[model samples]
Target: MSELLNTSEVFASDPSGLLRGLHRQPVLAVLRVSERQQAQHQLNLLVEAGLRHVELAVALTPAWVELAIELRQSFPSLRLGAASVRCLKGLAAAQSAGLDYVVSPILEPDLLAKAQQAGITLIPGVYTPSEVARAQALGAPAVKLFPASSLGPSYWNSLAGPLSPLPYCIAAGGLSALDARLWLESGVDAVALGGSLFETSQGPQQPLQLRPGLTALLAWLEQRANGDLLSG
Candidate 1:
């Protein structure tokens, strides 16, 4: 475990080039399925659709770490990570599998310190201004704004100013395509989606697939990316 925390140059300050690099395609996919094969298949689909960043959040199981490694081997350019990482075991799993980073539900000093030591980027979840300040003080390069849809996209706009230069913000949990548009417009650095893509009136918890809204969201994201390039 010491090797995990003591073997990189980006360990000192912040994610050397992690979150800052997501401006090109600002959508992150959070895969929270129970079946391993299903997760692999869904991830393959996301990659085919041009998604490069994803978090494996299926109960913080080491299942994610294993999947992240496999995905990386297949697509070297892909950015794979584990999610819901809230303890030492989770962090160890993240490093054991050599994932690019890990995401947590809340900021924990020890977890952050471990990430900093390992140079494995950690994007801790934040809700209020005080949490944001603490993350910034900890030198977090980015933070995930969890359950952002609960507060609506406007919440970001409300907090963005006072938290000027906020750690690269990612809006996650229950966000739809329109919500993604609004959050991005509100200056959220990125938006993450998971089971929301497959939600239906049915009560079954199905494994992720290229569901209806997903394709549309991908197309829209691609178009926005092109527009960003042209505008730039």
Candidate 2:
């Protein structure tokens, strides 16, 4: 059995084990709302619907740093992270805010190195096989495949091997409930869901609805857990 990393624990020497810990859940909800109240509400909804991992996209709100602090305090059990981190300053702010992880839309070597020095888990964004290799070289146990829909699942399938220390891929952008299964089947480690996973009928400010889309994701997790049932 793999030991769980405490929420407060900094980067361990073996970060791959940390990545594997996150992969156990395989779904990371990306919170991208502007209002602090709305973000809190959406986070509650996602948590209630069985999401244990989430990334708060910083660009979505001017008060993202404060909100990250508040959310971290509000939900002690949830693995909260800050996304859209563009530079060393952003990474430092996230770490200071007590976020459990950090993510970026672009791969920045300085930011990654600094995050490591700060003992924060940073998952940098990468799109191409070369970029993926670069991220792995930097010691990231996982990398976010931004605009994943642009490259599509087939492209991921092609990068199967040779990206050693091969970072686990988190598929983000242009992914819908239906498309998630394809990406997972194509060997992607996990999917980062944004606005599309919620119901739009209630307007953008309301808490997201977790049915249908979340249900599909849950089913996939169940199947993944029960390998015999899926394989047979």
Candidate 3:
């Protein structure tokens, strides 16, 4: 197996650069599949949707590692990462599968240490100052503001004063086009869309049609990027 890059090394390697590229487009589809076949199908749809980054939740059975490995090999340019990785085992599995990064729903110092030691990017989840502080202490490259909707954009805006120097922040959870502009305006590095982007009907095999909602969301992001709505 190839040696995994530690957290610091991964950050130095410009993991955020990869994220910035993905953000420039508009959306990143986070797929949480329970089956390998379904995961593969979702991967194809994401690619078709013009999304270059994906987060595969590790909580899925049969393991998303297998699918992640296959996709990494097939789409070398695609940024494949693991989410819901709360334990060392999950971290190891993600690294072994050649994941570009690992995201957790909560902060875990040991897991962060392991990821750093192994040389892999880590995006620990944070919903409070203490969690953000813990993640920063671990030298996390970025922190995912999970269940972002609960706290709203103001929460992120508040963090900017103290955590401004910290690595990037991504907002996830209950995110939609209506709120995306506000989140970005609040200083998030990027946003991850789950249920808002994928419907159960659009199962693994079915391709995602660029629906009005999705298109509107994309348009809003684009407008923000162009400085039409977002001020710098």
Candidate 4:
């Protein structure tokens, strides 16, 4: 049998191996909600859709701690993480909440070190070579290329040539099903998609309604994973 990973050892060795192992499907569900009900509903939907990884942001009111604990119990196989974490306090809070990983919108050395010491995966945000280098030096498992749409796929392609040794980079911000091919081709390990994956017309007050859009997105991802379509 495969050796079990202790929660604290998730980032101890090859962080990319850990990330690839946790998020093998190449698509991650990023649920940003301000209400308890909404968070639960989205979690259920994503789980049903076969997504094994989800990230909850701390900025969401009502907080995601309770939901994270509940999810850990309900979906033992799912890898839970927290996003929008900007400081050491936020990292501690996320770890206390039973999160398997922590994601920040910006690279913070102190916070990264704290996360490493805590033994949780850290995916820090980076927009330039300096930021990526800093994150790599701090032992980040992956660097989130935020606002990737603004930088375009070429930026990732260019970085890959020089930072080939760096851990996987996840492309977030403005990612959509239509652009998955381009982003994946750009050498990113995976993509984090938000609003584009859900039907927002139902509003936060109501449970998220998965419309045809979500189905289409999933189908596209499935096809890509199956090698039916060019990954790029």
Candidate 5:
């Protein structure tokens, strides 16, 4: 379980194995919403389409939090977490809503410590090697690279030399579903995709849907997990 994160293998320092589920199906769906009902329907579509890990950004109402907790209970295979968790208030809301994990857009040691005390896994955001090192020192189980699409998929590969055994990494922000294969192949533990996954010829940030493109991406990932596709 402590093997280095290869193409399909998992993390080296995941002692609690909180990320084992992600290793099997390596995409993190991050939903940003302004409507509660829309968020619920979107989440239903994702889980119904067999996507396992989904993060409901706190943009939705706290009522959405209740719905998320309920949906997670209904779908035992689903790993639901809170996104944009930057403060103790968000942490309290997630805790009350019964979220399994929380992700932040910045690395705040105080928030990380608070989450740790509450017995929750906090995956902090980081950009530089120093921030990643700081997160690891803060006892983070994983780290999310914010604005990752701007950095490109090859970014993690460059860090492999400097960081050696990189912390379990999740690439988030501005990533489209089409880039999943590229990022996964480039060695990120997971890619947190947003509504950009549904981007069309019209423009970006379309409503979430299980398009043929996304279905194909999910199929490809499953095949990779089953060893039918090339690991590298």
Candidate 6:
């Protein structure tokens, strides 16, 4: 753990390079399924479609952690992480489960410190410049722009300026293909697809598969983003 954290710290101050270097894909999909069967199916679908980066929500239950572990073993090349990590326990669970990183809805100082000490990558959710600054102060490698749909692409575009030493921004929450394209074009390092990708009318409680709509959208967004979405 200490060894991993030591390596993680090297990129703590400049996560943009790390994120871009590690995740060659343009988007990171968020999975919030509750059933193990459904979860595995959805993961397999995404992998088959060429999407590798994913954040499995930890709020579900111990099964979520187990699924993460299982997925990691099955898909060795998958970049798996935990999302909605609100407290120490969630962070600890993610670390124990051996996932790649943790995502929080809000930035917690103690959580950040502990993650740094444990060698886990904590991507805190941030919405404003102040929040972004706060995340940077905590040494976060990346800051997820939560409920990003609420702020719209214009809001994301507005942040491109003034936010010096900008952290790697992840456009998450209610992201559409057009929205994803706009965010990526607006300079966001990466976009996160949540319920919009894997969830269906059955809701999160039921097992779901990757939607054809989302698959098409991802392809379109990847092309539209063009040079904005890096491959190397």
User: What's the lDDT for all of these models?
Assistant: 0.73, 0.73, 0.71, 0.71, 0.76, 0.73
lDDT by residue for model 3 over 78-178, one digit each (tens)?
Answer: 78788889998888778778785778888888888877777677778999888887887777777888999999887876766776555567789889755
RMSD of each: 5.8, 4.6, 5.9, 5.4, 4.7, 5.4
Pick the winner on lDDT between candidates 5 and 6. Answer: 5
Q: Candidate 6, after superposition: displacement of residue 220 in Å?
A: 5.9
Give the winner by TM-score: 2 or 5: 5
Q: How far is 62's C-alpha from truth in model 1 (Å)?
A: 5.6
Cα TM-score of candidate 5: 0.83
What is the model-wide C-alpha lDDT for candidate 6? Answer: 0.73
- Identify the candidate with maximal TM-score: 5
Error of 3 at 177 (Å): 4.0
Candidate 5 ranges with C-alpha deviation above 4 Å: 1-17, 59-64, 199-208, 228-232
lDDT value for candidate 5? 0.76
Candidate 2 contains a number of clashing pairs equal to 0
Q: Write candidate 2's Cα lDDT for 128-170 as tens digits.
A: 8888888877876578899998888867767765544355678
lDDT score for residue 172 of model 2: 90
Worst 10 residues of 3 by lDDT: 1-10
Model 6, C-alpha of 36: deviation from truth (Å): 1.6
In model 3, how large is the Cα lDDT of residue 98?
77
Model 6: per-residue lDDT, tens digit, 1-232? Answer: 0011245555664332336443445688888757677777878888887776878888646776776788778877678888899999898778877875788888788988888788677888998889988887777877888988888766755765677547667878888644566677666777888876754658666655665555665676556556545642
lDDT per residue (tens digit) for residues 112-219 in model 1: 998888877888999988998999899777788987888787787677567775567888988875457767877687888877654443444654456555566667
Worst 10 residues of 4 by lDDT: 1-10
Off by over 4 Å in 2: 1-18, 59-62, 161-165, 201-208, 226-232
Better of 1 and 3 by lDDT: 1
